[model samples]
Target: MEKKNALTAFAALSQPTRLDVFRLLVQVGEAGMSAGEIAAALDVRQNTLSANLSVLLHAGLVRNLREGRSIRYFADTEGLRGLLGYLLRDCCGGRPEICDPLIEDIACHARPTPLDKIGQYPTPEDHT
Candidate 1:
């Protein structure tokens, strides 16, 4: 992420409500959650939640899509990953060992099982 992008994301996360909303979206994943659902889940007023969502949206941390009478919000994972990468790009300098454990944890947590596959599988030959 560029410095400006990182600043924007950081600014958005600086707010308590926006942070809560962003964390909620992250938990929801790609399918996301509707605005009403978010408000209800957080016990936040609709107007307050709306303002928070707007900040996250402006920061490119969340995206909104019209879903019937409601608007659904999803975490912009690419933007988030970019921000995280930018923060960690030079971490631990050349040693790498410090960040290696974090990288391993991320990989372990993100590893997909058969049930997590979103599409069809390929043969072993396709790995090459």
Candidate 2:
């Protein structure tokens, strides 16, 4: 992602409601949720949720799909990966030990699944 886009994403997540919504979506994963579902989950008003969702969509943090009368929103993993990669691209001047712990933390934060069950996440030993 471009530096400007990353800044926009960070700014969008800075708000309480938007941050909650984004985290909620991330937790929900690819199954996603409709506007109504998201509103009910967060106890946010439709109008307010719409505005926040719009900002997330613009920042490329969230994506929506039209499903009949409803729109299902998903966490834009690609965009998020790009943002994370940009931040960690040059970690501790290429020292894995300094960066491995941080990477582990990020992986944990990105998914709700157990590390053992989620084989996709790399263990510290994998990098060593």
Candidate 3:
């Protein structure tokens, strides 16, 4: 991502509601969720959620797909990865150990999984 794009993404994520929406979309994976479903899950009003979603969409953090009558919003993982990489690219300029643990953790969790595989999520049933 370009520096300007990273700045835009960071600015979009700076808002509380937008941050929650973005994180929720990330958790939802590539399948994503509809506007109504997201609003219900977050207990946010329709117009409010719509505005926040727009900002995130503009920031390139989320993408919307028209699925029949409903639009599904999914996280732009590539853009997010780029932003994270850009931020950490200059880390540990001299002392490699400064970021070794983080690199190890990322490597440990880097095993790829097919998007169709739905891991355990805290569904409504799980809440109770």
Candidate 4:
């Protein structure tokens, strides 16, 4: 991704509500949630959720599809992947080992497992 696009993605994620919404959408995958569902899940008011969704949509970090009379929101994986690639393109001085754990963390988060009190997540070492 270009610098401007990366900045936009980062800005969109900087907010707490937007971040939560994005993470939730990512977890749900292509089976996205409607605005009402997201609002209920996040315990947020409709107005607040609408504003957050609008910002995310403008940043290209989120996309929506019409489901009858409702719209379902989803994470824009292409945009997110581009942003992630841009961030890690020059990370850790070209050492893949240094980035392995980080990738594992992301993979862990992508699944729908409950986190423990210690916030321990499955790592590459866990399966070894």
Q: Which sequence of candidate numbers ranks them by TM-score, best first?
A: 2, 1, 3, 4
The residue-by-residue lDDT of candidate 2 on 69-92, one tens digit each, is 787888888878988887777879
User: Which of candidates 1 and 4 is the stronger one according to TM-score?
Assistant: 1
- Global Cα RMSD, each model: 8.2, 8.7, 7.8, 10.4
- Which candidate would rank higher by TM-score, 1 or 2? 2
TM-score (C-alpha) between model 3 and the true structure: 0.77
Model 4 gets an lDDT of 0.82
TM-score, per-candidate, Cα-based: 0.80, 0.81, 0.77, 0.77
Error of 1 at 20 (Å): 1.6
- Candidate 4 regions exceeding 4 Å error are 108-128
lDDT (tens digit, per residue) of candidate 3 on 53-110: 8888878788787666667788887778888988998788868798988878865364
lDDT of 4 by residue, 8-81 (tens): 88999999999999999988877788989999999999999989998888787888876676778888888888
Q: Which ten residues in a row have the lowest lDDT in candidate 1?
A: 119-128
Per-candidate clashes, comma-separated? 0, 0, 0, 0
CA lDDT of each candidate? 0.80, 0.81, 0.80, 0.82
Predict model 3's lDDT versus the native.
Answer: 0.80
Off by over 4 Å in 2: 108-128
Off by over 4 Å in 3: 105-128
How much is the lDDT of residue 62 in candidate 1? 84
